[model samples]
Target: MGIIRTTVFTGLLTTSTAAAYLAARNPVISPLAATDPIWTSSVFKRHNPSRNPATQDVCIRRIPLDKIRPELLQREGDLALEFCRGVWSGWGFAVQRKYLDLKYRGPETAKQLWTNEELAQSTYDRGTCIADHFEVVEKTPTAITVRCGDSPRKQDPRPSDGLFVISATVDKQREEVELRLKTCLFSSEGTIQGIKGPMPAWMEEMHQWYARIWSETGSWRLLK
Candidate 1:
């Protein structure tokens, strides 16, 4: 309850503090339920810069679960349904609000995870290095469970503790992949480092670049 409490509202609950708080409160509620939120936000540092190097924006996304997927069945597709009901609905709005101050292609990275298999596999690999072991626990018609390989070490209190369940739903009717990613936002104290700051002029230039991309592309469209 408290876990879901923080992600939905932007207060003092940072990623660095969330994991431990959730772990302490874990026995009562399922991690999947904890992921649900109407609103979610995050701040991330952009990696490489075309122009302005130092950019930080808090992005937010708000979406209704019903409008999100037309084909998600309620009874059979529980994991996928729960995740969409919880996270994905919020993720789009988070992106819209610029909560995750990402480097280049942050939104692209998220889109790729859902639509690209090779990229998803690479993500799985990266999680392995961060944790001791990772495994896909269950695979449903449209959902799967991924358990972390290693538990957060008691002494290593950086804010990572819990399992994740992701789902892949194929709209057989539409021939589209409806991939859903659901995970606990832990307090990793994890910060993206080594970004070379650009001049103020460069920031303006990069903004134009992103604006142009958003204006032109269907996925990154900027509404007038």
Candidate 2:
């Protein structure tokens, strides 16, 4: 009943706009019960660096599952991990993990939030606040993917590490609930570069406008 904590995870890269409206009026976004990803040995290996591909920066969102929010469906009963833990407790994702604990995608991933050690990467575990230098790889109950720990900081055209993908599925003939936001880039001579961050095109259009409002209002605002 108190598993899901708050703070941004996907399609997020900062903590500015007033900490995303105070993480959108904080209710801890209920709807827990969709948690997994505390493995190690670093996995998810897929690189294709010919130039630009990872869907050329992407974002998609949908939510309907009876318009959500009955104390976020009470708890873990897996509705695609309760819509991916209600889009990792939606709304501006704790100013996008406080903008990666102020790393801002630089100092080889600055503060390393939740640096694991069996969930010392806390936000009370499970629910997730992202950023232990991005590593999840892939989780189930719908989908989750996180990657990055490869670069030593090459600097070739800018970008270094890659992949920040999220997925949650449950269409059930359109009852609704589908979320995907991908920002794949890797070109410190590594490869697989999407949206090749040569840096400064308004910071790649403000990180594709914060990954399209962190995927259209952070997982469709869990029943707005």
Candidate 3:
């Protein structure tokens, strides 16, 4: 009787442990996920003189994990990294060869990780716009944030002190994800000193176009 009871107890313990492991590995879906892609933008705001004018654009899309290719899902970071790569390539930005390779600083299975300690830079629009470096500032199983520093347009009279931040989040339960891009234009001097003239209409239009492209097709292109 003692031997039978011990075996039964061991079996129950093993089953319970397996159930807990599975639950921990697979997170539940988030409530914020939507049925369709949603895009939104905010007017530029300056919180400080040293900081640049901040503008935010967000795109949220529903992507069922079961629908995605199994191979791509296994990669984990591929979706977010691919989206970043696509955006730069689509915008005509070329990352310098020296910064092309990224070395992540954290464990492979870490929910949050950082990359590009060497500071990768990219140039766009015939060297008119230069981004100093790319850094993975935040990461998690469901979210990631990429930041671009020392970005500025050649046309701007002030020095290049602006930056851009791009973030992506996944909601498994809702079967959706969200991508947000925020651009900040800063000046060495105070915000008052930074202003030379009104922003050109063409520049504003170009930014709007880029936002639209990322929201509509660029974010999901890799999955296809």
Residue 46 C-alpha lDDT in model 2: 33
Candidate 1, 104: how far from true, in Å? 31
Q: Over the stretch 50-77, how does candidate 1's per-residue lDDT look in tens digits?
A: 1112322211122233334443444565
- Please write out the lDDT profile of model 2 over residues 106-220, one tens digit for every residue: 5554533433232221222232324544555556555565655343232223345565656666667987666666555544344543443444556655666556555544554
Model 1 root mean square deviation, Cα atoms: 17.6
RMSD (Cα, Å) for all candidates, in order, is 17.6, 16.9, 18.4
**Residue runs of model 1 more than 4 Å from their true location after superposition:** 1-131, 152-159, 186-224
TM-scores for candidates 1 onward, in order: 0.24, 0.29, 0.43
1 versus 2: better TM-score goes to? 2
In model 1, the worst 10-residue window by lDDT is: 215-224
Better of 2 and 3 by lDDT: 2
Candidate numbers sorted by lDDT from highest down:
2, 3, 1
- What lDDT score goes with residue 82 in model 3? 51
Candidate 2 vs 3: which has more TM-score: 3
> In angstroms, how far off is 181's CA in candidate 2?
6.9
Q: How many residue pairs clash in model 2?
A: 8
